[model samples]
Target: MPLNEDLPRGDAEYLSQSCFQFHEVPGSKSVTARALFLAAAARGTTVLRMPLVSDDSLGFAEGLAALGYRLEREPDRWTVEGRVRGPAAEEASVFCRDGATTARFLPVLAAAGRGVFRFDASAQMRRRPLGPLTRALRDLGVTLVHQEREDHHPLTVHADGIKGGHVTLDAGLSSQFLTALLLVGPLSEQGLTITVTDLVSAPYVDITVAMMERFGVRVQRDGNTFTVPAQPYTATDYTIEPDASTASYFLAAAALTGHRVTVPGLGSGSLQGDLRFAQVLARMGAHVALAEDHVTVTGAPGGRLAGITVNMRDISDTVPTLAAIAPFADGPVRIEDVYNTRIKECDRLEACAENLRALGVPVHIGRDWIEIHPSRPRPAHIACHDDHRIAMAFSITALRTPGITLDNPGCVKKTFPGFHRALNDLRTIWHRDQ
Candidate 1:
């Protein structure tokens, strides 16, 4: 498939069969990309197997190439040659499109380079906030100027060696800021000491720690303070585990559609924090079986969905899936600890409520939490707001309703480029263009 092609659209009404077979481990592309960049920063050759080849990861690879790193991709693995001595930052520009992971990770890498370079992106990427990271970079003596909005993207980084020190951040918005600093902290001249205020999505930081260890870096954590030692990362072979966040949708499908779904690559031991989503499924009355390399979910008998309240700070990525399954439950479901969702690809809370209302589900939105009530079935075409999670969440509703049409279904390419194909592989699909 072409990189820029729109996602294929089809009426999900034809999804009547059960049982899904997923072969690959759901690799965490975000972790893989950051690990690869760190390997490159270490100036040694590193081999990464089963790394995610999604658009976001590709964007990061492109930015690294512009900075003088050579990356070779084989059918089964990728090799990155590091530019550990720092790249000559001679006025280069990288277009990150809508990939925020690229937009954030590359700037920190650029901060460690020699000259000045510009990083710009599509309209959506430009709107994503970069204040926390930009401020952190500035504190490290690196010159960073935003070309457009004050805290938004399309920024320039004038390279200088990192002089890390005590820093504080509001983690309520996005964990990407923390992830960016953590990945680059090992290269700081004095290392880094960070204090976080109101940190949200703490599990993501755990993933960062796991990746850091894989690259031969150790971070000391005492409560909210993280201390990094000035040690170079060791280049070694790494393999990315399957994306637990993406697997949430399939788990939800099994819970909602009475199908026995098996998502491979997520077993008893996975580094991704979103793996805790299986606990959420078990809480919601689904039968969950954890195997050595995969998880199997079976729907409750007679589709008796349970109601529970959860603070999803660590697993905020699965909020949309939870919201999609809310209407089928026996009582109201409350999802909290997700104020960060407001600034994600879209205002997920409002978008989810709006989409659920359009489908005739009674949903009440709060500043962070949303309460969803069961209602009579009413199928409607949903506006995805160009958010991949939103599009996937609503697609689950199609299984219960007559069929829910998704506008701009192609947004799934942001993460699972083969999402539609994977869905089709599980069942017979019927699609028609309007």
Candidate 2:
């Protein structure tokens, strides 16, 4: 299992749905991964309720288990007996399997403990840059050896423990680099002070800091500088929120089909940055209602949508979701300031343009922007490029436009495994109503 390995394609079954009641999405993958790491590093048993059972999440939990942490799996929840310390194995091997969070964060977690650890991932993760975070860890006095490429994965770390001190991170490439540093900071012997330069996706850092606080650690933030006190994670019972990124697909479905769709259990109060996607839809003329426990979206009756010009740097994960609906907008939809998207699971900007163009939509791709002009989307087989977000986002287009088959629908298993089944259920309800 190396990065960029080919994956099998699956047919995306089209669902004819105009309206549907709220559907419960799975737990947040981001939150679930973070919580698992924290709980594993805590002092006692920690119960996590409603954790997502997806490839990426399960991969992370398995990686932790490989490092000698005890995890008891249940149907809907997980019980993890904390090691109360960083990984102590003499030599631990972790398989990231293209989960960038696991690949990035786990190394830092290992560096915070005593051991020699090696990390490798799927071919895709091997292509992603890990130099910045690796460099930052070295700056914090951890001996990191990149077993493969200089800044890429297949790396090994000889760790005594994190000697927490001041470090500066370049956040221009990916925000997860900053997040990985922050997550390991509290476990350092002297704590950690981080000065982030050229930060992108700042909201995601907010999530890391907030989750740290929930696990009984406070991150002091002043602009780009953060001070993390050396503290031990306390075990507790925690519940994960529904994934806002996964919910974006259904919300876009409501907008694309001129129907109402609701995703329950996540709304305005969510810590996930993708929740801002609902606001983007609202700005694009979809009727978006955010209650305390749920969020709903209703499309215009005639498939009319407003084109908007906005910078999506902080909420770049939803770029594909927005691109899916961009062709039907009243004017050109300009999404800018998302250069980081070029390095995601796929080069999202290029993938969006290529797929939309395949359907005869007028699209202009730039270094950091995509502008989609209103046009009819013809049926085309969308090449998902083995990227989960690309597959899920294009499924939104397939809802209204027929013959739009996703080449790698199985890729959604990385995050939302039951996507097609949930989608088909919508079809069942919508047809019965008809």
Evaluated at residue 5, the lDDT of candidate 1 is 18
lDDT by candidate, in order shown:
0.78, 0.85
Q: Determine which window of 10 residues in candidate 1 has minimal summed lDDT.
A: 1-10
Top candidate when judged by lDDT against the true structure: 2
Segments in model 2 whose C-alpha atoms lie over 4 Å from true places: 1-20
**Candidate 1 lDDT tens digits, 109-180:** 878767888999878777778888788778778898998788787888888768777788666678888888
Q: How far is candidate 1 from the true structure (C-alpha RMSD, Å)?
A: 7.1
Error of 2 at 388 (Å): 0.5
Candidate 1 Cα errors over 4 Å, as ranges: 1-20, 24-26, 428-434
**Model 2 score (lDDT):** 0.85
Error of 2 at 167 (Å): 0.5
